[model samples]
Target: MCKKGNEVDKDLHSLQLKNFMGLLVPHQRQIHAFILYLVVNRADADDILQETLVEMWNKFNEYKDGTNFVAWGLTIAKFKVLQFIQKSKNYRFHFDPQLLELLEHEAIRKNGVHTHNERVEILKECVSKLQTKEKVMLDLRYEKNLTFEGISRQFGVSVPAIYKALGRTHARLAQCIKLTLEQRGVA
Candidate 1:
């Protein structure tokens, strides 16, 4: 009976972790960007994101299952950022501690549990509705991760022409997305 109970407990923990991850994935980019805003160095920001993820995982049990995991994660990230700052006094950061705190609070306010899924839906629709040429350009630039020059070569166009097309496409997509979001009343 004791051994069976232990297995059940372990299984329950695993299930809870899966649930936590479902909640965590949506806000991951925002979390990393928050860390980057504080640390300012790409490498150091990446390290802090790793550390924050580990800490969040380790302390997963302390979290209430349906609560705001982004907020909780950001709290942990803030501490990690502070620790890094403390340890790296010799290193110069873009903002001092006070500025970081203000930025963190403001960022959290701006990005807190946004209409992420809705935005993704809107973006997909916008992309799909693109003119054929613009859609191909987007795929080349984004999906293939090609540079303007590379895209130009593939499309048999000048780099400047490619750049102009990409810019126009981006602006059109942005407008479409904004209109879609407004229609959805996501303000």
Candidate 2:
């Protein structure tokens, strides 16, 4: 019950999946080692490896036939490692200054693209110095992407209070990032 083009597409999909699996199976160990190097912990590296493989499987359809499979797979693995580091409980970001500079350069090289890694680190340091409630409020707003209404509902606080808290947090974070960047001669 399929047209000719549909049958051809189905066959192509099957071939792509098979090829991707073939590539991944052979490179699994290398992939794991690369992820481990980035994460620097055995358990976290294992979790990231599993997540990366699952993501690659789910996104296999997006891979172009006859393209560089290893590069694409490594890209997915890198993204998973970054996400794991960002969300980990005992998170300690240890990126070198040169790597940070490279990332910043890449962000600027991309048209209309933006990243806040340096600013986020400075904000994290400053927020760690904040009172618990203020830190929690800021995290809920920015990190969690919760709207004022949603945060208000969750915390049973007034929307205005949430707004005020966020405003104050934003001001403090801005000042902190400015100071940090200035101290590092990067601003």
Candidate 3:
């Protein structure tokens, strides 16, 4: 009876880890966006993501099967984000945590409506409007996953110049998305 109980416990733990891992990786992009929306800093968001992953793994045994994993993960993420905010009080930022929850809810809702193919169609049109130079920068940055420094070396331009060019390109693309959505009455 003791040996059977030990095997059952190990099997349950294994099943919990398997379940947690299955949900963790694919939802990472959405999770990171939620973190970013709350923290408003990419570097800080990345740190929180790592911490969130660890927390999720540590608490795998506590997570019940058949519940919404995204919600559970977001609850953990929200706590970490609030902690980061509380610790950075000296930074003089005044965002309300309640608003962060609203943002998270909105983001998840929006994510469901905006399909990848729809974004890709809008992106193609936006990319077409970009200047020849900006198009190359976008291609190198995304299609090739090249770093700004690599792009700078390739173009014989300074890294800051590459950064600004890519930044402006991104802003332009965002504007295009906004305008496109408004035209479709989707925004």
Candidate 4:
């Protein structure tokens, strides 16, 4: 009877883990985005995200079914971000606790509605608006994966010129993307 009971417990544990993954896999992106928005450092945010996932899994049995998984995950992420901020003494610029709370609230409010795909599509359009010379330079640097020295050689200009043109192009692209997002009521 004890052996049978142990087998049943094992089966139940396996089922719960499977169910947890089913929910977690879909919401991982949202959770990562929330952490990224708050932490602002990709490496730290990624580490926090992994910690959040492990913490969530450990507490999975406490999670009630039919509740909002994303909300639960985001709540864990928010706590993890707080813990990270607290532990990193050399950060130089720490957010006030109240300000961090407010940002977390705002991130939750804007979570799923943040359209990454739409932004990528808009960025493509903005890139297309660049001048022919600008486009060629961008392609050479980005698509062909050439060094700045290589790009300067190809363009027959100084390295600083290439850097200046790329910087201006980046600023223009950023402005264009922002304006387009605003126009579409998505910003």
RMSD of 3: 3.8
Q: Alpha-carbon error at 71 in model 3, in Å?
A: 2.2
Query: Which TM-score value belongs to model 1?
Result: 0.63
What are the per-residue Cα lDDT tens digits for candidate 3 across 61-127? 7888789787788889988888888887887664686887788788777767675467779989988
User: How much does each candidate deviate from the true structure in C-alpha RMSD?
Assistant: 4.6, 15.5, 3.8, 4.7
Off by over 4 Å in 1: 4-16, 29-48, 78-114, 147-149, 156-168
lDDT of 1 by residue, 1-187 (tens): 4568889999998898888788788878878988987877989999999999999999988998678888899999989989888887898665776888888877776575355566577789988989998988988888999988899889898999998998999899889987876776654
Model 2, CA-based lDDT:
0.74
How far in Å is the alpha carbon of 158 misplaced in model 3?
A: 4.2
Per-model CA lDDT versus the true structure: 0.84, 0.74, 0.83, 0.86
Please list all clashing residue pairs in model 4, or write none if there are none.
none
Tens digits of per-residue lDDT, candidate 4, 74-162, equal: 88888888898889968876677887778788887665555556756988999999999889989999999999999999979999999
Quote the positional error of residue 132 for candidate 2 in Å: 55
Backbone clashes in model 2, listed as residue pairs: none
Poorest 10 consecutive residues by lDDT, candidate 4: 110-119
Please tell me which predicted candidate would have the highest TM-score against the true structure.
3
In terms of lDDT, model 1 sits at 0.84
Identify the superior model by TM-score, candidate 2 or candidate 4: 4
| Rank list by TM-score | 3, 4, 1, 2
